[model samples]
Target: MIQIANRTISLATEPFVIAEMSGNHNNSLERALEIVDAAAETGAHALKIQTYTAETITIRSDRPEFRIEDEGSLWSGRTLFNLYEEACLPWDWHKAIFDRCAEHGMIGFSTPFDDTAVAHLESLNVPCYKIASFEIVDLPLIRLVARTGKPMIMSTGMADIGEIHQAVQTARSNGCGQIILLKCTSSYPAMPGDSNILTIPHLRELFETEVGISDHTMGTGVSVAAVALGATVIEKHFTLDRAAGGVDSKFSLEPDEFKRLVEDSAQAHASLGRIQYGQLANEKTSKLHRRSLYVVEDVEEGTIASSSNIRSIRPGNGLEPAYWDLIIGRKFAKDVKAGYPLSIDHFF
Candidate 1:
């Protein structure tokens, strides 16, 4: 089990829901605080923000590689540096955001994109750190965050098995032992078909650590399905109003949608009780409604038992259905009514 703030996150507990306010603040501090309030109201366990500036995340260059050329991308035609600048939360605003989260009883943390961002988050005494999907290959950054000895969550978006293994190894070797690997599809507004949530369980088995999903899908269906497949944490982008338009507003969930995600994901986790069979506590009382051997017709003493006199029926208060063949040729020990339940004392 991993403890974030005062809450324990594990397979034994409800999925830890995180409201990721990544670039959804619309670059307004007031709106950012409002988003925190909305998230807390939705009963989310934690709130996450990104900690990086354009300078810290990328270089100012017009090179083809530095520009997003994919027309399908949300920020198509924008340079990576400019996109980061527009999306980044101001470092000075971190304290207010964290304090607001605490006031609302939520654990506040950030995804650090660079070593300097890690140092800044450490100064704030944040409870944990998240490694964004694109940085899973940045072993140096992983080591830097791990050395802080805080629990770390890494998103495996574009990473292959070798890259994920290296990142996990680096973190453990440094100092962080509480690590969570999130199954992430890097595409913004990602399609459910590409989610591949089945990886959640495989990741846990392979790494011997908790696994979850950083869902970018348009709705909560994917997140809820992830929990059923053994996800212990669920992180989704959140916004107060998508129509207001922020960097990630196109894909982020609104407040009501986020609330549903929290509620539905918990229900999904609860449904995964265990590898169980037989009657449960709630089901025990309903067993009486099941079919069993019953005296369907009246029978007098010394009467021959036959299919016409006894049969499997509902309101189980008779011998089990398995005994039907055995009682077929037996004689009645006593008189029985048409509605009476059959028992050993009524048959010889």
Candidate 2:
């Protein structure tokens, strides 16, 4: 179990829900704080923002390498520099945004893209750090964040096991003992078919750390399914209104959808009790309705019991149905009436 700012995250508790406010703020600090308010109202445990500027993240060039060439990408044909300029959350707004998160009883943190960004967050004294999927390969940044001696949540999108091993090793070797791996697909507006969340448990087993899902799918279904598969955390991009439209709005969930995700994920986690197979406490009364041997027809004393008079029926206050074959030729000990429950004491 990992504790972050007084909250315990483990399979034993409800899945830690995070509302990613990534460029959904659209450069407006007021809107960003509003997103925080809305996320808290949706029962989100935390709100995450990305920390970096266009210059820090990319070069100001429209060259071929600087432009996103993938036709399937949401930012296709856009220069990486221009895209980051728009999506990067301003550094000056961190304190205000985090303060608002505190007002709503939610933890606030950011995905620092560079060592400078990490220092900025460290100054704010963030309780934990988040390593974005793209940054998992940045050993230096991982080393810096790990040395902070706080819990680290890393997204494993498009990363192979070897890459994950290096990131985990760097963090652990540097002093970050509390770690959580978020199984992510990395695709903007990723499809549920692509979200192989079964990897969540496998990740936990392989890394010996908490596991979760950073879902990009369209609904709460995949997130809830992840919870059942033992996801200790769930992160989804959040926007106040998809209709308003922002950089990440196409894949981001609206407030209502996020609320349902929280409710359903919690319920799914609660339902994953233990490996149990016997009748439960709630089933005690219902068990009485189970099929049992009963007298379907009248039978006089000394009469041989037969299938015509005895049968398996409901209301389990009788001999078990398993006894039917053995008692088939047994004699009735009394003048049993129709609808009588069959028991060993009722037969000779």
lDDT of each: 0.93, 0.94
Query: Candidate 2, residue 47: CA error in Å?
Result: 0.4
**Stretches of candidate 2 above 4 Å error?**
none
Native-to-model Cα distance after best TM-score fit, residue 51 in candidate 1, in Å: 0.7
Model 2 per-residue lDDT at 166: 100
Q: Which pairs of residues clash in candidate 2, taking residues 3 or more apart in a chain or in different chains?
A: none
TM-score of each: 0.97, 0.96
Q: How accurate is candidate 2 locally (lDDT)?
A: 0.94
Q: How many backbone clashes does candidate 1 have?
A: 0
CA lDDT for candidate 1: 0.93
**Window of ten residues with lowest summed lDDT in model 1:** 339-348
**Candidate 1 residue spans exceeding 4 A from truth:** none
TM-score of 2: 0.96
